[model samples]
Target chain A: MSERIRDFLRRRDDDGPCVVVDLDIVRDNYETFAKALPDTSVYYAVKANPAPEILSLLESLGSSFDCASVGEIEMVLATGASADRISYGNTIKKERDIAKAHAYGVRLFAVDCPEEVEKIARAAPGSRVFCRVLCDGAGAEWPLSRKFGCDPAMAPDVLEHAHRLGLQAYGVSFHVGSQQANLQAWDFALAMAAGVFQEMAVRGIDLKMVNMGGGFPTRYLKDVPGVPSYGAAIFGSLTKHFGNRLPATIIEPGRGMVGNAGLIEAEVVLISKKSEQDEVRWVYLDIGKFHGLAETMDEAIRYPIRTEKDGAETVPCVLAGPTCDSVDVLYEKTPYPLPVSLSIGDKVLIEATGAYTTTYSSVGFNGFAPLASYVI
Target chain B: MSERIRDFLRRRDDDGPCVVVDLDIVRDNYETFAKALPDTSVYYAVKANPAPEILSLLESLGSSFDCASVGEIEMVLATGASADRISYGNTIKKERDIAKAHAYGVRLFAVDCPEEVEKIARAAPGSRVFCRVLCDGAGAEWPLSRKFGCDPAMAPDVLEHAHRLGLQAYGVSFHVGSQQANLQAWDFALAMAAGVFQEMAVRGIDLKMVNMGGGFPTRYLKDVPGVPSYGAAIFGSLTKHFGNRLPATIIEPGRGMVGNAGLIEAEVVLISKKSEQDEVRWVYLDIGKFHGLAETMDEAIRYPIRTEKDGAETVPCVLAGPTCDSVDVLYEKTPYPLPVSLSIGDKVLIEATGAYTTTYSSVGFNGFAPLASYVI
Candidate 1:
C-alpha cells in the first residue's frame, strides 16, 4: 500500500468500509506508460475509475480518454479535454446515445458490425470509426467472451460500409483481454489487425491508426510484466508486421493505470464454522460482492488481504460479505487464507482495488451504502 | 404484463430503460400468502426492493419487515411501522449496528454462531435471537451455499450460549433456497428445525417460534407451484414433525412478494453475428447485468422476455447489455431464443423483474444511469 493511503487510514474515523486512492501512484503509472510507448497516445479508459480527480490529473498530464458512453464523454469534456481527445470506445451503443455523443463533440467511435457502422454513419456523420476484431483472450484471468468484437475477416466490410456512408474509416482495434498475464498475447491480435489493414488496402482505403486495446494487467497475487516489457513486445510486433509503413498507435489502459493506486479497509464482522468437523472457518467482512468485490464472481480475481494479526498462524477460511443474499460469499471454491487469530471488529486491508471496485458497487444492496472513495 | 404497467409505459416519454411496478400485483401476492398460511406472520424481506412506495404499502397492510441492515431498518421505520414490526434477519452484522437497531427498538435478530450471539447479548440485552441452521438448498434454481447458517446439529449450543448471556433464545430459522422448486424442500428444512426445537426443550428453554426463511419461487421462464402448495406442504411438515405442539411460525418472502409485480422495458441497441458463418445473433440491450439484472449472472435466472414480434419465427440469440465489459453478456451459455424479426431500436419487455432489479444496479457503470423505477 502507498504511504499516503496508510496515513489516511490511520487518521480515518469512519464507521463503514471505504477505499483510498493515492494520486501519486496514478501519476507514476501514467509517466511509465508515456515513457515506455513514447510514440503511442495513452487513452485512459474512463470506465475503469472515472473519479473526477483521476480524470483531471490525467488531463493535466496530456492523456486522452476512451469513453464508453455519452455520460463518460461528458465527464472527459468536463476535464477541459477537447472532444478530439475523446474516443467513444464501446462498440455496442444506442443510436440516440451516438447522436448525443456527436452533439457533445466526440468524433471518434468503435464499431464491430455493419449495423453499428450504419448507426454511427447516420448519427455522427463524418466521425472517424475503428473496427474491433475478435481476440480469443486465452491467457486472461478474466477472459473476455465473444461479446465485443466481430471476426477479423469481417472488419474490412464493416469499415467499407462506414466509408460508403460519408464516415471516416480511420483504424482497426482489438483487445487481448483484461488482467492479461501473457506478454505475447498482443502479437497475435496485432497480426489480425495487420490483416484487416491489408484487406482495407486492397479496397484502396489506407487505415491510419491501429488501436491496441487494453490488456495490460495490474499486480494481484502474482506479479505482472511491467509496462516497459509490454511496450517492447508491442513495438517488436508492430515493426515485424508493418515494416516501415507503421500506423499511428493508441493504447487504452484501464486497470493497469489505476488498479494498484487504491486500497480498501474493511472490518471482520464474524468468524465461525458450520460444524465441529468443519476444517474451514467462515470469515464475514463488512464489505462483500455487492459492496465492491464483484470481481470475485467464480473466484476469477483473488485479491491479496492483510490484517493486524498477519504474522500469526493462518487457516483456510471461506470469506463472505455481510448481506442476507446467499450469493454474497466471496471466496469459497478456493478458500482464502486468513489469520487464525483474526477476531471480530479487527480491520483488514484489501489490496489492488483501485480500478473496478467503486463502480461495480451496487447502489444499496442489502441496505448498505455504496463504497465510499477518497482520492488522496 | 399488467394493464397498469402497460398504461404507464404508454404514457412514459422518458429516455433510457425503466422498470414499472404495479402495486396491485403485490397486493394480490400478499393476500395469497396470507390466505395460504393463515397461522403465520409475513415478514417482507426488504432487500428485494426497498422502494418507499412498496415498503409503505406493505406497512399499511400490517406486514412486518425482515431487514438486512440498520439502513433498511430505518427505511422500514420511516413508513410509520413500529420497531416491533422489524427483525434484523441477516446473521452477519457489526456490534455497533446491533446497538443502533436496539436503540431504534428492534428486539429480534438472527444468529448462527456463539460469537454473534455474544454480540447480540452485549449490545441488545434481552432481544429475541433465532439461530439459523444450514440447508442443502436442493432443487433450487438459485441454490444458497453454506454462507449464512451453521450446521443443524450445532444450533442448540448456539442458542444455549445466547440463553446463558442476557439474550432470549427465541427459535430456529433456515432458508431452503431462493427460487426453490421442489415442494419437499421445506419438509427437510422443517425436520431440521424440529430437531433444534426438541434439543432446546430438553435444555428447559421452550422455544416458541420457528422462522421458516424465504425460498418461495416466483414465475420466470417456467411455472412454479403456487403459494397454496408451499403453504400446505409446510403445514404438513410442521404437523408431522411437531406432533400438535406447533410453534408460532414466520415466513420471509422477498422474491415471491415482489418478483412478478414489475416489468422492465428496454430498447434493443444492436443485433449482430461474430462471423458470417455464425448461426446465433447477438442482441444487445440498453440495460444489462449491471443495470439491475444481476440475477442473470451464470444464467441462473432465466427471465421471460417479450417482444412485439413474438409470433414470428424464432432463433437462438445471445443477449447482452450495452457496456464495454465483456462479462455484461446475459444469456450466453444457454442462449435465449428471440423472434427472427427482432431488430435494432425495437422495444423489449423483461417480465418478473420487480424483486431484485433496482437495488442491484451500479451507481453508474459505464456512465449508464441506475435502472429507473416507477411504482404505479
Candidate 2:
C-alpha cells in the first residue's frame, strides 16, 4: 500500500465496502510492464475493472484492450478508445454478436474453427482473422485446450478454407491455460505457435499477429510469488525464439495488471462469538456476495484484510458477508483478527481486491446493489 | 419445459445459457402459497429475482416483499409496491442504508443488536421493529447461528431496551438455513419464538409478528425428496402454539416460489475431450460465472440440463461456461441426456433457475453481462 493510499484511507468515512481503485498503482503496473516488454503491445483486459475512469487511464497509457463481449467493447468505446485498439477476441460468439462487433468497426477477430470462420464470414466478411491453435502446453492444471481453439492439425484446413472463402485471415494465437503456475507453459505455447506458423508458411499463407491470451496471475494472496516477471529470462527467451521477426505480439493482462491496485473498505456489521476451532472468529462485513467479493467464496482467494484505523493490531477472523447463505464467506482462514473490541459499527478494509473482486464478480444477491467504485 | 419455450429454443439463431422466467408460473406459485397459508402475508423475497417485471407479477398477486437492501427495496418500490408492504429486513446494515430505507418509507426493519436498535431509533424512530433471534434448532445443519440474531437469552434485554427507548418493537424473525431438509427445525424455532413472545408479554411488550424467514427448499435435483410441504404439519403447530394470539405471519419464500418458474437457456459452444477423466466431455455455454449459475456452482446444486432443437437427437454432456477459468464448470455431472445432439451451434436450457440464479446473483465477469429476464 502506498503512503498516498494510507493517507486517503485516513480521511474517508468507511460506511460500507467503498471500492478504491488506485490510479497511481495502475499506472505504475502499466509502466513497469511497458518499460520491460517494449516489444509487445499490452491490451488491458477490460473485464478486470471496466470502470470508465480506469479504462481512460489505460487508454491514456496507450494500452490496447482485449474485449470478450460487446458490452466490454462498448465500455472501452465509452472511454473514447478507438475500435482498432480493441480486438473482438472471444472467438466463440453469436452471429448477432459478430455483426454487432463489425457494426462497431472491430476489424480483427480470433477464430478457433471452420464453423466460426463461416459465421464470421457471414457477419463480417472483410474482417481480419487470427486462427486460434490448440497448443499442447495446456497442461493438467489449466485446461483451455478442451473448450476453445482449433486443433493444430485442423488449423491448416481452417487456414485453407478461409483463404478459399475470401475472408481476410491473419496470424495464430493460443492460450496456454489461464494462470498457469509454470512460466515454461508460455515457452511451450510459443514453440507450438512457431510450428503452426511454419506450417502456415508451408501452405503459403502470410500471418501478421500472435495474441498470447491473458492469464497472468495476480498476486491475490500474499507470499504467492508475483506473476513470472516480464524481465530477461522470459521476454529474452521470447525475442530469442521469434526473434525480431516475431509477429506484432499482444498480451492481455487482466488480473495481473489491476488485481492488487484496489481495495474495498467495508463496515463491520456484527461480530459472532469467538470460535473454538483455531480458525479465526468471524466478523460479518456490511458488503457481501453482491459487492464484487463473490470470488472470495467461489475462487477461495483470500483478500488481504486489515483494520484501516489501526493496521498493526490484527487478529485472524474468517470475514463473512451478510448474505444468509453459508457460501458468503469471504475468507475461510486468515490471520487478521476482527479488529479487537470492534463492534457492528467499526470499519474493516479489505486489501488487493482490485481485479476480479468487483467489476466482473458482483453477483448482486441479497438485495445489495453492485457497490460503487471511487477512483482514488 | 413448455412448448413455447421449446419454440423459443428452436428459433434461436445463436446460443448460450439464457433463462426465461414464466410470469404465469410465478403467479401460480404465489397463488398456491397464498391459498395454503391464508392468514400469513407472503413477502416475496426479492433476492430471488428483483427484476421489476417479476416483482410486479408477485406484487400484483397481492404478495408483500422482504427486501434485504436498499436496492431491493428500491426495486420493489419501482414496481409500485408500497414501502410499508416491504421490509428492510437485513439485520446487518450500515447507518446510511438504514437512513435510505427510512427515506424510502420502509417502516418495518429488523435489528439484531442493541447498537443496531440505537441506530434505528436515531435514524428511523417511527419504524416498526422486529428483533432477529438466533433459533439454533439443535442438531440441525443450519450455519447462520454463527451470524446475526441475538440469542433467545439476549432477546429480553434487547426488547427491554427497544421498549424503553420508545422504538416500535413488533416481532421476531429467524432464518433457517437454505434448502432446509429438516422440517422439525421449524418446530424448534417457533417453540423458541413462542417462549420469547410469552416472556415479552410478561414484560408488558406486545408483539405483532413472528417472521419465519426464508429457508424453504426448492427441488432442483431429482434425488432430494422435495421441500417438506409447510402445509398442515408446520403451520398447524404454529397455530397451536400461538393460537388466536398469533400476529400477522411473514414468510420470505425465495427458492420455493420462483426456483421452478425459471429456466436458463444456453448454446453448446464446444464439446471437447477430457484428458484424465473417463470419456471426459464438456459443453461450453455462453453464461459463465457472471450469471446466477455461479451460485448453483458454489452451492453444489445439481441443475438439470437439456438440449433443444426443432427436433434432433439427444446426448449427455457436462456443461461449462465460456470464462477461461477452469472453475467455471456449470455442471460437473448431468443425469439425463441433452434433448438433442449438442453441436457447437446447438442450444441447451437448464431448468429450475428462477430463484437465486439471475436476479440476485450475477456479476459482469469475463466481459459477460448479466442476462435479462423476459416475462413469458
Interface RMSD of each: 0.7, 4.3
At residue B224, give the lDDT of candidate 2: 38
Across residues B1-376, which tens digit of lDDT does each residue of candidate 1 receive? 9998998899999999999999999999999999999999999999999999999999999899999999999999999999999999999999999999999999999999999999999999999999999999999888888898899899999999999997889999999899998989999999999999998999999898999989899999889999999999999999999988999999999999999999999999999999999999999999999999999998888999999999999999999998899999899999899999999999999999999999999999999999999999
- Give the alpha carbon lDDT tens digit for every residue of A134-185 in model 1: 9999898878899988988899999999999999999999999898889778
Off by over 4 Å in 1: none
What does chain B score (TM) in every candidate?
A: 0.99, 0.89
Worst 10 residues of 2 chain B by lDDT: B272-281
Could you give candidate 2's per-residue lDDT for residues A1-376 as a string of tens digits? 6676677878976445677888998998888777767878888878778778889999988999988788888899888888999888776677778899899989888877777787788888888888777766453233453456766777767767777778776878877665555667778777777777778788888777778876666665545434435434457556766787867788888777887888777778766543223345567787766677766543356566666457455566667787756566666544345556666767667778787767654556776657767777
Could you tell me how far off, in angstroms, the CA of residue B50 lies in candidate 1 after the best superposition?
Answer: 0.7
